[model samples]
Each structure stands twice: as structure tokens, then as C-alpha cells.
Target: MPSHHTPYAINVRGLTKSFGGRRAVDALSFTVRPGRITGFLGPNGAGKTTTLRMLLGLVRPTSGAALIGEHRYEDLPAPARTVGALLEADGFHPGRTGRDHLRTYAPALGADDRRVDEVLAQVGLDEDAARRTVRGYSLGMRQRLGIAAALLPDPPVLICDEPTNGLDPEGIRWLRGLLRERADRGHTVLVSSHLLAEMQQIVDSVVIIDKGRVVYDGDVAAVGEPTVRVRALDGARLAAALTAAGAVVEDAGDGVLRVRAAGAEQIARTALREQIVVTELVGEEHSLEELFFSLTEPGAGQAPATIQETAQ
Candidate 1:
């Protein structure tokens, strides 16, 4: 994780919340720094949404408080000027043109129409898109429009919940670059996504929550323990040889074996001792899905991506 500096863009202290007798957020506290992208990951029932709402003063925390920069969101001199959020991209008026939606918000932010054009162009929504009603726009277009709205005032901090929702692969790529650019401009960004495989390509760090509490909070790459997966003939004999060689080897699903204690070279040497012919020798790269499951309850699989149509 990047070293933290004081005067955080977002801070929560002893935050807690409940819904229908169940606690959704429990004494959660963290700081989000400017010029960084902190990813929020959690299971469906995790209190991520509730926590975000409380952070923005949209929902009163059952206990504790949060601040946007030095001021609580309600205490901000100008809420839109201090911070902008895209909790749900579809919250805008579907019948309104993209330009009109931004125009409605621009004046209230003490910003002019020039800022609107600048942001719209920055998000790659051209003048033609400005004239088209959002209802007629594709999901990619809507996502860009939402981002444009968040950038309307060029707030120092941004919060987005699954901003990549309904976007094509190229759209996802564009959004990643846009967020990175915002961070480079000294803007703080807190992003939430359930899709784990793609997050490493974008986020700087991660804070994972499960069952309404923090499970891990650190660099995204440091969450999981490394393991090596190997395949070879006479697998049983190879496993025995690995054990004798002081390596941790166990049966993995299918015909594969997982060895954690020793490196690939060691595993290969041990396999050769048992007259085994090695076929595949590979080290594991942690997946967001695997790390999520490890943090949460065991055996709870990832929600399969049914949104592959949008991936094109």
C-alpha cells in the first residue's frame, strides 16, 4: 500500500450500522488518500453499499461518523464541490440528453457549461452523444455520462460503485485509464467491483469486506499466500517424493497437485527422483475470486459473470 498522508480525502471512524436487526457495518475505519484508487470488494450481503451511503451522509450511521476531506459531507461548504459520487450510474433521468443532465448539475456547482464540454469530451462522449437521450444510449455511453457528471466540478474525491457495470471490454479499458488519469491529477477515488480478474489491472490497493466486516486491507497483490501447481506422471509417487523432499504437497482437484512449501525447481527435482515425468509445472497467480473466497466462508464460489455479452 502507498504511504498515507494526513488530510485524507475520505475517513471513517468507528463506523457501524444495522438493518432489520442485522449489523451491516461494524466499527469500520479506514482512510482513502488522494491520487490513489482503493478498490472495495465484498460478497453480495457485505455492507459496502451501506458504508458508502454513510460516508456520503446519505444514510445515518447507527454509530460513528465519516468525513470527506476535513469536513463531514453534510458539513461541506458545497457538497457537489467537495465530493462527487456515482453510486448507481442509472440514477439519472433516462429521458434527458447527456448534455442536459450535466447542464442541470453544472450551475449548482458554481461551474460553467465549459466544464461540462471539457468533461464530456474527456470521457469520450462526443457532441452527438450529448444530443442523444440516455434511454437511447448504450450502457457504455451511460457509464461515460455518469463519469462525466462526477467530473463536472472536478471534485478532489470520487466514489463509484461498480462503475464498470454493463460496459464492454473496451469500455472497461477506457474507464480504467480515466480513473488512473483522475488519480494522477491528485483526485482520490474509491471504486467497488465484484469482478475480480480485471481489478488488478486498475486498482492500487484493496479493502475487502465479508459479512459486514473487514477481512483484509492492504496492497491488492499481497492478500493471498502463494502456491505452486504441478502435474506429472506417477502422481502418487511424485507426491511421496515431494513430502520426502520437505515440500508441502496435496491433492488438488482433477489430476493436479498443489505444492506450497517448495519452488518449482524443487518440485521438479523431487518428481524426477520418483521416476515421474513432469508435464506442467506452474506457479499460481492469485485471482481476486480465489482471494475473496479465502477471506469469506470456504466453498462459497464466485458469482459467475453472466455479463459476458457486454465483454465484447
Candidate 2:
């Protein structure tokens, strides 16, 4: 569905932003729905940060607009009450304890102390650490604190940029689990990250931007065609069988071949006709890392990648 008419959790229409006479976001438009984790993905300079800044009302847009429900972020009387953001630049005070920092934002959003402790625990931060100064908190702990602050208001929508930065493998896994849990609870989660390998398993949908334009936006799995690996004795004989069956097979050399334009069943049927014994038949799951490269690479261009945007 079009972001213009859809009632997604987050909506942007013709959202454009500029920096130093360069278009960071150009006529960008998309929607993020509740109960799903939408990935905000792009390369290092792919306008992900600028677009997010505009959505959170941190950076004024050069043109266009974004809205959280019917209200613009800046126009909302209490932003944190409706939308929680965890941008890379946003964090707690170094001198203040993790618990105290949340307390400061709580009353501002009319949140109670009891709710504060609950959210801290929800994000896996120890409430006992409330007395400890933030200066001693590790990068992972600080991230947990940021998530706690975002959850404190019990907002329906969340916007987080590079939340797993500076985190170890374990911490990254923990953060992914937390985000998935929030989405499962009907919270709309928007996460932007350059690391596609890490984000793939969690995000339900994705909106990928490139060179100030949306390259592909769709179900992460549906972005690429299924890949298959084939192995057999007498590679040439097998390829000939596939070709005779109206399939395209390219000889990749070294007894290896790349099969396209045909599926496993067809290839198997053809191989049986030629009396070729197949050694292995496997389907390749296109990983997020591979998909990202194919979508953004030079020769691949914009044609092969398909963008599917729908609202629930």
C-alpha cells in the first residue's frame, strides 16, 4: 500500500532532506506497521540517518513531511509518550546513575516511579544498578539504559538507529531478542543498521535506500529469487540434460556448474531421463549480506531488486 493513504504506525510522504546542497533523502516515502520490525537499511552514506532525524523531528526537513499516526512528531505535546527514539547520539548522562536518568524523563512524560523500575527490568537492566553511576556502565549497559528510557513511556512506536553499535556478539543477540519481543507485544519498531547480516533474522520487512532513493522495500525473504546448488557425476551430461529440458545451465568450469531458469524438480526429472546420478540437490537461502550486495552493486543496478510495500 502507498504510504500516502496507508494507516501504518509510521508514515512518510515525499520526505526530503538536504545537507550542504546534497540530497540526503529525496522524495522518500514509506510506512512501518505495528507488530512488525521494519528495517531502515542503507550504506554508510545512504541517507538513513538524515531520514531518521527528520522523522524524530531532530533535523528539519528541506521539504516533505513524516508523521507518527495523525500527529507530526514535533507537534505532539509529549513526543516520548507516543513515540520512543534511540538514536546513536541519544544516551544518558555519564555522571548520573542509569535509574536516575530515567527518573528525569519519567515525570516529563507523566510516568510513575513504579513504571520506571518495570521498564528498566523489561530491558534487562538491573534495577539495583540504579544507584551506580553511568560512568562505570559498559557499552552494552548504556544501550540497555537507552532502551529502558524508550520503553518507560510505553509508547506505541519506536525509532532506533544502529542500536547494536559497540556491542559484543552476546549483547547484539540480546538486543535483537529485546526488539523482537517489543514487536511481538504490538509495538512498532523501526531499526536502521548498515550491518545487514545481523539485522536479517529479526526484521519482518525492510525499506532500503541508496543514493538518496529507495532501492528496494519489501519482505526480506521475497527480495531475491531462490538459489539452488546442484552436484552430480558427469557434470557435462547433467548440464546437457537440463538444457534439453528447456533449462539454462552455464558451465562454471572445474566440474562445477551454475543452474538458473529451472527448479529442482525439473532438473531432477531431466537428469533421470539421462541416467545421471545426482550427488546433491540443495536450495541456497539468500542471506541478508548477499542480498545487500546484489541489490546495491554496480552491474546489478536497480532492475533485479523488487520493492514490495504493503500495509496491514
Candidate with top TM-score is 2
TM-score to native of every candidate shown: 0.75, 0.78
Model 2 Cα lDDT, one tens digit per residue, 1-312: 001122238888888888888898888888888889999888888888888888888899888888887678988766767788888634567899888899898888768888888888877777578778899887778877887887777777888988987778887888889889778878889999878877887798888888777777788755444645788898888887777776667665666666766888887887788889888777655667776777677665754244422110
Clashing pairs in 2: none
Please, what is the whole-model Cα lDDT of each candidate in the order they appear? 0.79, 0.77
Tens digits of per-residue lDDT, candidate 1, 115-227, equal 88888999888999998988998877888888889888777788999999988888889889989987887788999888887777788877778766777666665434467
Give candidate 1's whole-model lDDT. 0.79
Query: Per-residue error at 256 for model 2, in Å?
Result: 15
What is the clash count of model 1?
A: 0
The predictions' CA RMSDs to the true structure, in order, are 7.9, 6.4
Residue runs of model 1 more than 4 Å from their true location after superposition:
1-7, 224-282, 298-312
